[model samples]
Target: MRPSGLRHHHRLETRAVTRFEPNLRIPGPTSLPPSVREAGGRQMINHRGPEFAAMLGRIQTGMRPYFGTQSEIAVLSCAGTGGLEAAVVNVLSPGDRVLGVSIGAFGDRFAKIAEVYGAAVDRVSAEWGHAARPDEVRERLRGGDYRAVLLTHNETSTGVMNPIPDLAAAIHQESPETLILVDSVSALGAVPFEMDGWGTDVVVTGSQKAWMAAPGLAMVAASERAWAAMEIAQMPRFYLDLRRHRESARSGETPWTPAIAVIYQVDEGLRLMAAEGAENVFARHEACAAATRAGLEGLGFELFADAANRSTTVTAAWIPDGVDWKAFNGEVKRRGVVLAGGQGKLAGKVFRVGHLGSVTVDEILGAIATLETVSVTAGRPVEVGAAVAAAQRAAIEAGIARVPVAAGA
Candidate 1:
């Protein structure tokens, strides 16, 4: 037998369980409401069961107001990219001419997806951190005979929000037959997206972003014109078949097994969002974005995107001189705050701050405080109190702050 002292010396290692804090800093997979999380924990139902059908029908009905469309909502057991693929495959045939506007990584992905589907993709490249103007898109559409035009309503990577209404009007004016497919993954709910009123043929979004639910599900709404185009298109598709989804959804079911847990969460999240009112949700995003920008400016960090085109979901800030971005990011992480790094060609030069679904003024303030501490500690000269104060001022002006406070008070 071992000695008595040795027996008492056994170390008990206790690991700290990471608590689920609301994600108030980024655009997607934002903080889920407690009610949504509770719903996600509900007992799973059979995919083909009546309960599932009822849930699916209720979700489709809930999505209508967010999309601002009377078109059928196709729920797919995939991410936003799946919805993008569905849009490409369902409405266009192989060797069809398509024009894709590329302002950031997501836009580039759209062009790549089109190419993979055997479309003759013409990329209209624009400078990163800026929106491609309607006139520019118009020029490209007028210059070629294309079957469709692809655009992103919000380029999350560069924090640029495109002017969709004006762009749609321009496309219709120049090439009325060219179908319009928009990736509203980051813009839906956070911004006003009127698919029917704007004449967009197809709009795709995911549950994670503005929906404030877990990932793994995508939603698409296709106009009658887009459905008509799908009827004659020769593109090959099976699991992502919009036609099948449309048919099944009409019957209040899905062609395949749905992510029951995620659907439960999505249903609850959408219910909460609808109850708060879509316009109010959009306004919250706008105010949060403005506050974030004002806070960053107050800290003396330069914004990467133009003011007019700034995304309501995220903001890209250039790394100031003398600050070690890596170290600063590490410090923020150590403080239990996570921020997104720049993607593509912007890596290391900038960082993204998300202000989308479920974010609050206090969370934004906490992040700003962390930023201020890290920047100052890393030898980057920043006005410590300025950013937080500016954010507080913005919160008050937007009526988000319950108690009024002066800008510098």
Candidate 2:
């Protein structure tokens, strides 16, 4: 007889038997790579010691290519939201006129941060599933003497990727002096962002998303113009102050104690990324996005984001009709594939699949297969293995290596 511990209780019959093989498919606090997870477990080091200093130096310098900037970056021991707050308070003063472009939930949060910091914010919004048009942003900037413009590179909530290069150009053409601050927490490593070439003044990202690490650190980079503005702009900052972080970074230290473990994970993640090469990293994300979208569509689910503006890191699809979101999600969870729910106004109507940071086509295929099984189990009509086949083909066409087959007798 099998051991009692291996047997399932009747009371928990419906629970997913995913004790050892759970797959994380959420937007962030993503599944870490094996090497990165190992790095996180190395014995803790002195935060003020030379070893910490060297690690700090490597992280800041290593992250430049991802941001596409030569500007100095400050690594703060906070979440991505904290990075947004730092961007707001460090660059604009109370009552300063600002323009905020919002396309989804994260966009709204970036704008809201500006408002809470006392900036007189004027919002330019797009439909939830669409990208903000450059012409619309230009029209808003016309004849307005704004101190700064807040932008989101990728709105994780609605699965939209804003055209930052085009939008930045429009802002500069209309108001050259206006500083451009971007929240790229979900875009930097997974997608390409050219900070210096695009004339962006400030950009921020977190460790959890594309960096393939656990969450805890936010990396921020600012241009010379932003630094000039920081010297005078005051919105009352201490712990979230970019100036203090930057100063401490010059000495390979943080003003406050850093999240040493997460930093270790990020450093190792960066090394892996560097080895893989940046362009390849972007291509892998593109392939994963293609696979996820194809799989969801093959299963008769409609995608939520507009066609041309879809995000490469996360894909949002409308929950199928007649299926209860909670029940469906629970079944999927039980099968070992954990997905993200719709956020804000989209709550209960959509499901998001995150495919960034060390996620592979094979893993995505497994998730697609799981979704197929769950859908069929819920009385939904799904063509058996159709979604998985579609995903495999899509991944191959998008430049990922084709899956290998076993030798037959």
Candidate 3:
């Protein structure tokens, strides 16, 4: 018998199960490597010291490849959302007409941020779990007098990755002067995003997401066009002022007191990623997402996002019918794997499995196995073992690792 969150009557197991240090499977503040943890534990140093400058230098240089910009990158003591706000306030003024290109919840949040700051936002929406297409963006741009455009590289809520390059092209073709601001919070370092190549003016990300580091730091990179907008755009910003940050970055420092501990951890994480190679990291994330999705489908689960727009960082899916998703999620947690529950309208309708950052093949399979045990105990048993095998096979096919035997064996 297993512990059930459902009070309506479910099997109960007297054999107690204890799992320590549950596997974290959330989109941000992802699983950190031992080295990053140790780095964070180091004694505090002078934020204005030479040592700090060197550390900051290393972080900036190492992270540039992933940010896909030769331009300056600024690290702020803020999360990804803060970075998005900074991008908006710095580039556009109050009542400035902006186009919000939304695919899911996060994209909606991006637009709301602009609206809150007094930007007149006109949104172009796509169905939940589906990405915004280029044709739709071009259509929106055709008639609007937008001063800036807001886009999200990855929609964590619905597990969708938009076609940013194509969208950028359409925006450029229709409204070349409008600043393009992108939220790459959960996508950078884990997916293919070339900011400079795509001609994006501003792109922002956080240290916690695919950086495999702790939270408390947001990174922003800007092209010359965005910096030009910052010079004239006035939105009464003080703490998030990028002009001050830009000047400070030249001196290898931040405009304000930074998150020194998270910075230390980010330095280590960036070091590891640099050694791993950017292309390799992206490949691993893609392979892991593929394997996780295949495993979920094998277990008789339906994916929430469309296959054509599925994200490589997280996989969102509906729990099988006849099983309370909350109860099923609790079982997974009790078994030592904490998956992220959905939010907003998605709520219990979906569960998200984050496979980005440092997630490995073994971790995915272990979580699947735990879900299998819980599902069977819940009386909705499926041959999840075969699904586990499918994941292993997919990994092998992706050149991630070799499998001893297939699931049927």
Query: Which 10-residue window of candidate 3 scores lowest in summed lDDT?
Result: 400-409
Error of 1 at 208 (Å): 0.7
lDDT of 1 by residue, 274-325 (tens): 6677767776776777788888888888999988899989999998777777
Tens digit per residue, CA lDDT, model 3, 197-248:
9999999999888887888999999999999999899787999999999899
Evaluated at residue 24, the lDDT of candidate 2 is: 85
Query: What lDDT does model 3 reach?
Result: 0.85
Task: Please give the range of 10 consecutive residues that has the lowest summed lDDT in model 2.
Answer: 400-409
Rank the models by lDDT, top first. 2, 3, 1
TM-score per candidate: 0.91, 0.94, 0.93
Ranking by TM-score: 2, 3, 1
The stretch of ten residues in a row with the least summed lDDT in candidate 1 is 400-409
The collision pairs in model 2 are: 16-334
Best model per lDDT? 2
In candidate 3, position 4 carries an lDDT of 58
